[model samples]
Target: MNKKTQLGVPLSAQNRLFVPVLGASGGCGRSTTAGLLACFLAAVGSSVVLDTAPRLTSPWPSWPTEHGAGLASVPPGRPLTRHQAHAAASRSDGPAGKWSVLTDHQDWSHGPLDLPTDPAAWYQLAATGAWQAVVADTCHPVAHDIVAARTKGQRGLTAAWCALPFAVPVLCAPTSGTGVAALQTAVKAITAEGLPLQRMVVVLTATGEGRTPPVVKAAATMLESQVSAVLQMPFDPHIRVHGLSDADRLARQTVAVGSALVSAVLASAHHTWGDPLPPAPVPAVLSRTAVDSRSARPAHHEGVFT
Candidate 1:
């Protein structure tokens, strides 16, 4: 560890990737593919931070005044309703540098029991400073109390309170056979509610409208080996301009299948195992030549160690 302190710590900092965009059910588009993959990783500069897991409804851009900064909301059994406070005071007129959308906790629906028992002090205040990337349009299907409040407290500080190491659960089934018995009963209810089956993946969203390839290899053998990888999004037309337009419309949206999923999430951002793999397993319908060959390469992903 010497060489001017190992060349001033480089080697890509041992891999730093944290993209969470699961959705094989509640809208296969996963927040319009995480808002066009966070506008193609901030249009190639990369300083993204689009979090969301507390309870759901906080897509970012709603706090014009109901309570102001610190975005509030405590609605469930009653008491704590403030929710957006004018979207945290318009994130203080964001856009001076960009990348910093961390709404501590406000309730999206009941996800991870509205986690917030100190998520690494809001993930070190949202990975402070020179941000690299952080996209997180998550919520839907995998929600074991927000994966135990994101691995809570000292487990070495639970992925350093949001630095995360593995939480990619995208399984939007429906290729038939009752969507392979509801994706094998949701992988036996997340491996009998224990979690971490080598950090599962399993994707198969809207295959366009042709359903073949043995129905995507019989839903990848129904999560046989507790699923490690599988993705295939066939139906394209720029993914049907995301449910008839909410915003983006670049001639139809498939900016090269969302820029090959933001270049496979910036080539798996350093890779200490935080997010990347889970986008191949289709057949609820698709064909236009397999949606033009899954928008030409960058098909599903796979991982376990490196």
Candidate 2:
């Protein structure tokens, strides 16, 4: 048998939460948020873990040099097969019941690339036994195969077999109306399955802490209607210290900001809506349509050209 924990709750029961750190676009602190959340969970003896995926937006370093841990990037593009993903998850090391991290490469632009399809081996591996709380940092166009597996896998199966690992879409809080319109479009795609908008959490970034513009407030208000939760975090000063030499400072900074986000997640996990919900089942109207309209919306950078 694999190393067992004291609770013996089994991997699935133990890993009640599956967090996918997503942002409206890249460079909006999605990766940093994932890394820091892992550290915070570990510090609190929660057996935390963070898994990354193959994405074109951000570069994956060999190790989490900044935080002084084992936050490594997985191989990107086509090479990330199902067999490879399962093997990596099985091989990782962590406290018996604390946490585990894994990553896969499934390009989003191509359309749903199922885990059972890529290598077809993971479907079985996940059923057997594996890590708890698998946090996958997904690629853009969020509705991909890997994400589908993590969110809405076949029910009545083992955690490895079933999907629905608490999917959180990280949205960059835009300052302009145009940005908000684009976000609305993405929300529609995420909630299309009717899997409970609560499964989605929007992480708002780039407001630079302390000062939030009116457009930012409006955007958050609009998204709150579409998902379970909305969180706000400014461009943390700590991320500026990249590279191994700045590890200490970076780790400290990550821990500080990451902890707050984690608390919100834990709190939101058990509760219903704290604020008025956003418009459910957003109509098929997104920023593309907004562009045609002459609304004085905020201007935000759209990540990923495709």
Q: Which ten residues in a row have the lowest lDDT in candidate 2?
A: 277-286
Query: What's the true lDDT of residue 160 in model 2?
Result: 25
Per-residue C-alpha lDDT of model 2 across residues 210-230, encoded as one tens digit per residue: 577787687788767666667
On the 0 to 100 scale, the lDDT of residue 95 in model 1 is 16
Q: For residues 1-306, write the lDDT of model 1, one tens digit per residue.
A: 332121122223223345566543544556555555555454433334444555345444432112223324312212111132223322211111223344444344434534443433232222322233445655545433334544673232222322354233334464555555655665555555555433444545554566545755766764545555555444566436433123244433355555555554444342424343332222122223434454322212210000
Per-residue lDDT, model 1, residue 141, is 56
Residue ranges of candidate 1 with Cα displaced over 4 Å:
1-19, 22-30, 33-135, 138-168, 171-195, 198-201, 227-239, 244-306
